[model samples]
Target: MQIRRVLAATSAAVIAATGLVACSSDSSDSASGDSESSEQDGPIRVGTTDAAKKAWAVLEEQAEAAGLDIEIENFADYSTPNQALEQGQLDTNNFQHLKFLAEYNVGNDSDLTPIVATEIIPLALFWKDHDSLDGIEGESIAIPNDPSNQGRAINVLVQADLITLKEEGLVTPTPADIDTEASKVQITPVDAAQTPSAYGEGTPAIINNSFLDRAGIDPNLAVFQDDPNSPEAEPYINAFVVRAEDADNETIKKLAELWHSPEVQAAVDEDAKGTSVQVERTQEELQEILDRLEEAERNS
Candidate 1:
């Protein structure tokens, strides 16, 4: 989860009540909803968020080259694909990270698992025309209004040398937890979904990649990215998620294999302009990462 989902984490329950549709438990023959019936079995079902269209296009090409057909469904909200998968409405999804998956599974009791990680997308510090972070007056910083995202924003500020943390590895940072008064930067705490709009007010904003891209900001041009390759990225690197039971399914294995191929990495490298790095972690590894995140959250 990035700042947007993090910001929505607390309010997620309320929103989940009214925002999400009922869960579905309809799984198909293949792990990702690709029927084993025949090659002519229409199309292989694939579900993902609206934000992931670019990456999936490359994946789609890979699938076609691998002799598999693909049908891509764009989900508006973040919660539907899993439910659709449970209902057998979809074959596979690729929009979430490990933290989101763990939280979702714990809350919903869904057995969704991730076979491999895809990209390390950083929740970055974005600004409209402020040349550099040095130009950002710490007196005012607009952060995501959501609790989880607020923490992420706080952490980003800390990373930019704009502030520091009371604890080294706290997960959810609150206003009261600013470590030092000298760096006591004021935060606007705008809603995560609205953060991209916060930039024009002469205030730097921290937001997720979707919002950043939606605002037409080149994510690569951001003043600072959260450093997904850093050791600190241990708790928050993003991944392509699926049901836990599908962890070893052949379709998932094939997809994961393709996702990890040199071709995919090359596509990412070439297409993203170095804004993304490939990630590949096993289900156990993801669980371990989630466990670490839970511990961080607990002590935050």
Candidate 2:
């Protein structure tokens, strides 16, 4: 997303299973050249918060299958998309978690909703061969300093048994939550996107799939990541978000239908090469996940 503004301190935590406004994969570049020009009235304009262009290759196929053409637009930041959409700049947009979308609507007065889910890409924990999370004592454990995603990244560590929290911390957890005086490893929070590259200092770094993918490191290299079956999987999973009024819109439905098709799921596995896997959930299931995430954020 070539954001005119870098949005704000994510009003939410960094990496609970549900992804926030920022996505590191699909570089912040223009959507593929495959798009038809924007002037045509038959093509619908779809805006995205991240590098949706890459995944949008599939979207293009979906549109073709549905007998509609589209002009894909990309945005880097999570904030203000509703304003862009409601203002009629885009026919639809697919970015930000439903929670972020809900918060955006509450904060900005719009009625956006999800037509369906696409895929949930998990944020992974990468480290040099430290053997196991158990033996890496008295070492540096790098997380993010960003208020939105830091704690979510750390929770990955806790889930992997690398560290324990005195209690679950806020949207972003500070080092103090680690019982720093007694913890085996020294905890340090780096910038969210910088953690993957921060591995050279002999500390294990936690990063999201987008950052890790952008860094070109193999996902298999990561010592730990969220399990697909784990309770923490919801936040990391993503969806095709839209306006509430378009909940029944054919274009949006066709786009989601294409994504949920078995063919697309197989493509996600092949395209991601096993690094980032996709998930299937019903509309009701997506709603439940959103409710659970809100509950977790409230609890955190």
Which candidate leads in TM-score?
1
Question: Residue by residue across 135-201, what tens digits does model 1's lDDT show?
Answer: 5654577787755457767888888778777767666678777766757466777777777777766
Summed backbone clashes in each candidate are 20, 12
Local error of candidate 1 at 127, Å? 2.6
Q: What is candidate 1's CA lDDT for residue 179?
A: 65
Residues 1-300 of candidate 2: C-alpha lDDT, one tens digit per residue: 111212223332332234432222221121221223332233456666553434566656656766766666655445545555665555567665554554455556555666677665666666676645666766787887754466666667677766677776334355667666545566678776678778755568877665665677676677777665665556556677655545556655566667666666666665565765566677778767666655555555
All candidates: TM-score: 0.78, 0.73
**Runs of candidate 1 exceeding 4 Å displacement:** 1-44, 294-300
